[model samples]
Target: MTAIPNETMAIIAGGGHLPQLVLEGARSMGLRVVGVGFAGETDPSLADSMDAWQWQNLGQLGKLIAFCKKQGVSRIVMAGKIHKARAVDLRPDWRAAKLLWKVKNTQDDVLLRAITGELESEGMSVVSAMDFLPHLRSPEGVLTRRGPTSEEQADIDFGWPMARQIGALDIGQCIVVRKRTTVAVEGLEGTDATILRAGELVGPGCVVIKLFKPIQDARLDLPAVGPKTIQTMIEAKASCLALEAARSLFIHLEESLTLADKAGISIVGLRS
Candidate 1:
């Protein structure tokens, strides 16, 4: 891998393992990583991986930008998930309040785009986390020991476009289907909840489809799945998992594939 130019990169970390992965990737490429972690959302342990770290609440955009500028950071990467429902109680600073007032709605893409624009206006470019670790991107074709059966493949084919449509509308990235029938569509509750809900409604053998939003800014909010996803599928009795290849990040790929195979689940990476 080519080393990044001698510069410090600021990571705007949210939650989950992705932030740490991005930090490690940046360091491996010889870039200094300074992280600004969300108080409730980001993993507390993530601070250990950074050259310097500071904690801030979700709505402290002014502080985040100020920190980046103080550290002389020109590039920023936003990684991991932020639970949207929790934003209801966020104590927004004046800058964040101003940005919030400008947006008509709080949809994921709209809010993220506004945030990106805010950072760019301050002379900092927001970059995709995948640029640091391209290997984490899902590869095309079957990843598990078994490919999806004909019925499951049919369900995948049926659900793929619907997933894209919802994603294009910035509704969600994942949908659960059984025998070509919609079982559940993920919303604010998130992917795991959506899968478990499908299991309750359909009993078993449902397929989960996750994809990137067709109109989404790829630098922000890319779809991701990990070991916890397979665990959720096992509990939900989901039989197949399909993710958009190269656009979605698959964390712990080997371990996830092993668990899926052992549980008799099929995983496929599709170009769509």
Candidate 2:
């Protein structure tokens, strides 16, 4: 594919390797990228990955906007997981505080939507996370060497609706179920912890389902799976992971698949 014109772009980074992945995408697209990474949340390695990097506190909206303007960035992308717990230390400048005041709810989606609006109003468009890495989108199929067994298929059908219900509640997107019983539900603690917890409690052979919330904005909160997800399943003794095909991102695909195969775990990109 031809690269996007090298107009400056800005990344409001969070935690995880997603920032690094996004940086790679931006550079490959021929975009000169500037990054504003969150303190205590974004990985430090991001600085070396970007064209220009600036570390900023999580709530510094005005500063972020100014930095992008200074770097001549007209398109912006926000990626990675910002620990929700860190919101307690939010130090919103007057601009951010004003935007926050306009929002009636502070759920992750609500807040992010507000931020997107605010950024757009400031003349910077928020680009989709997959703008440069379209291949990362989950494809339709049973990705692993082995497809889900009959029992796991039963669990997939069994847990699909319940898992969606959990996502609807804004609680979390991942649920580990055994025999139609939810052994673990992902919360702010995140997916790996939830899976490990389920493994310890449910023994073995649990099925893990991770989906992007039906209400989630694909441009921002797309569900993602990676090598670490495979490792979590291995540790949890889970045999299958059913993720939403096309909507989810499969990071480090070859390595993740290799790990899953070694662990005898099945990774399915469920159409649901």
Candidate 3:
């Protein structure tokens, strides 16, 4: 594939290592990257990795749009996690206020959908987070040194449809199963918390399944996992993690797999 064009690519970041990865990916692909990180959430070190970086609170829609325009950014990608709980303190500008009033639902999809449309209306096209970081996309088949046991495989197969259904409804993108029964579904608390909760509820050998919602907008968000996921699984006594291959982001793949191998946790990236 050709390298990313030498265009101005703006990254609107929130929290987690995902934004940092996105910056690195963009730079490697030959793009001039500018970053807009959220206050108190995004890592400040991200600035060192970008051509230019600025911080803002979660509700500064006007500032974000202005920053992009000033940088001559034609393409934008958003990465990292923004805790919805923090919306309680949101201070929206006129532009953001108008968008908020137009949106009927405050659910993740509704909010992001509105934001996407707002950005597009302002002439800033949102690029997929994986646009330059395709390698972070999960690969098919078993990824860890050890494959899942028969029982774990059975759990994965059993939970696959249910997980996808949950995802389709936007209830969550992850489900924890044990003995073919769901233990926990990931919602706002996120994957790590969900896995820990599942372990507590189901005890040992629970299988975790994570997949992109059937109607998920790849340009905006996708379920993500990393090395910390393996640690959480091991702590919870989980035996396996089945992620939707190529649809989910596999952050920190090398360290994640190393930890999984050491913990005897099976990591499988599956299609469907």
How much lDDT does each candidate structure score?
0.92, 0.86, 0.87
RMSD of 2: 1.8
Best by lDDT, which number?
A: 1
- TM-score between candidate 2 and the true structure: 0.94
Reference-based TM-score, model 1? 0.97
Quote the lDDT for 9 in model 1.
92
Q: What lDDT tens digits, residue by residue, belong to model 3 across residues 69-90?
A: 8998878898988876686468
Global fold similarity of model 3 (TM-score) = 0.94
Model 1 lDDT tens row, 1-272: 35557788999988889999998899888898899987779999988878888898888999998999999887899998888788766888999999999998878899899999999999988999999879999989999999999999999999999999999899899999998999999999889999999999988899999999998998998899999999999999999999999999999999999999999999999996
What are the per-model numbers of colliding residue pairs? 0, 0, 0
RMSD list, candidates in order: 1.3, 1.8, 1.7
Cα-based RMSD of candidate 3:
1.7
